[model samples]
Target: MIREQLEKADAIEARIQEKKQDGAGPEELEMLRIEKARMLRPLTHPNANERVYLARRIDRPHLKDFIPNLFTDFLEMKGDHLYGDDHAILGGIAFFHGRAVSVVGHCKGHSAEENLACCFGMPRPEGYRKALRIMEEAEKFQRPILTFIDTPGAYPGKDAEEHGQGEAIARNLAAMSRLTVPVISIVTGEGNSGGALAIGVANRILMLEYAVYSVLSPEGFASILWKDASRAPEAAGKMHLTAEDLVEAGVVDEIVPEPLGGAQEDPGRLYASLDKAIQEALCSFDGMMPEEIRAQRWEKFRRIGNGE
Candidate 1:
């Protein structure tokens, strides 16, 4: 069902783009972009696998897309000090409604060549370290931290292991747990394993309605437990990795809804919704003492899945 919707949506989007490039009338283009887009529909109750596909759709907005739309004055920071910069994870300073903030997230580029350059958003140790660097700076300036998560996992290559991937991830977890400022993480797409979690620990965790957050990808889970990747769909069902599941489990604070046919089809609407979500989250931390903020974050995590 979703596959068909995606195909239809793609065709409509391509048509709109082609018409624009060919100097179509504004009314005609708007009719196609809006009215024709209305033809694309969403499942009333999509299965977990269907949602997973939506989350991984090539047209879905990524961190690179979200940053420019959601924030202002973004000054990108790079390098881990220990090694060269990793494009898989990008971070830096930005302003949210004029308030200084440190922003970071996995960067899964839009094109095949770009994704190859970004290692498909799988970060190495240095990438995590770079994220930590920007975050620690935020800690010093007493600015709120905002991280966007969308990675399958950290790089599993021998080179990443050699550079202490586990330790780097651990360091982030420990440091984030102790941060005095507000830490908000939004899982805009696939959030799997430690790559996602390294930047995910926060006072508030938000996920897109179609996003999936999990310990690992279903394929990996099936490969490890059943010794067959063919059971990935079954694994995904059992894993309960959808935004709805995570919110019910208290693993996510809120779900930022996407427009029908997903964020790619209506990016402006997604950004508008997300902008409000971020504002509410930031406002919730207003007037909170640094210790109070850290304590609230710790208490939030402590109660997750323990049935507070």
Candidate 2:
């Protein structure tokens, strides 16, 4: 169903590009707009797989993609100091809404070679270690920390295991939990397993509408439980991975609604709204002491599975 919508949307986009090439009239532009909006109606009412599709949408903006539009003075810091740097996870000191903060997140690549180089945004041991290093620096400077999570999961390869993938994630969780600065996390897209959890132990966690935050991708879960990945849509439905689901379950502090259909449909509006949401969350932590913030976060997670 979502695949069909994607096809239709792509067709409309092509027509719009063609019109631009030929110099479209006002009537042609109007028709194109109406057709695009009509095609999006059903997709806006998305199911589980559609939610996952939006999370991985190629048109959706990424961490690095937002730099020029949403932030400035991005002085990137590299390497974990113990090991080499991982391109999959990148971070730096940046100004968000005129306030300096440590910004870190998964960086998905645009080309096939780039994707392979970054391990398709699936971080390994070095990536997590690098995140910890930058986060500790944020705590030292008394700057707030902001993390953008959009990864399938930690790298699950022989090399990753050899270098302590599990230990890296565990250490990040511990380090982030004890950090004294206010930390805010946003699930901008796919947030899977321990990779997501490592950066998500923040004072407040927010998720974009249509994004998925889960222990495993629906296909993976479906294959394990039903012996058939074809049942992924059903698995997605049962997992409660959508931002709406997380909000209702008290797993997320807030849901930042994407523009009408989704973020990709209107990147400008989406980024503007996201900037506001980040600012508001930061404001909410204004006078909070480190211990108070930690206790609040701890209690918040503890209550997620509370009450049968």
TM-score of each: 0.95, 0.96
The TM-score obtained by model 2 is 0.96
Residue 301's lDDT within candidate 1 is 91
Looking at model 1, the pairs that clash are none
lDDT of 1 by residue, 32-56 (tens): 7775556664455678888788888
Cα displacement (angstroms), candidate 2, residue 23, comes to 1.9
Q: Lowest summed-lDDT stretch of 10 residues in model 2?
A: 299-308
- Model 2, C-alpha of 137: deviation from truth (Å): 0.3
Task: Judge candidate 1 at residue 267 and give its lDDT.
Answer: 93
| Deviating ranges (above 4 Å) for candidate 2 | none
* Model 2 Cα lDDT, one tens digit per residue, 39-102: 8787666887788988987667788787667788999999989889999998999998789999
- lDDT of model 2 at residue 259? 70
Candidate 2 lDDT (Cα, 0 to 1)? 0.87
Top-scoring candidate (lDDT): 1
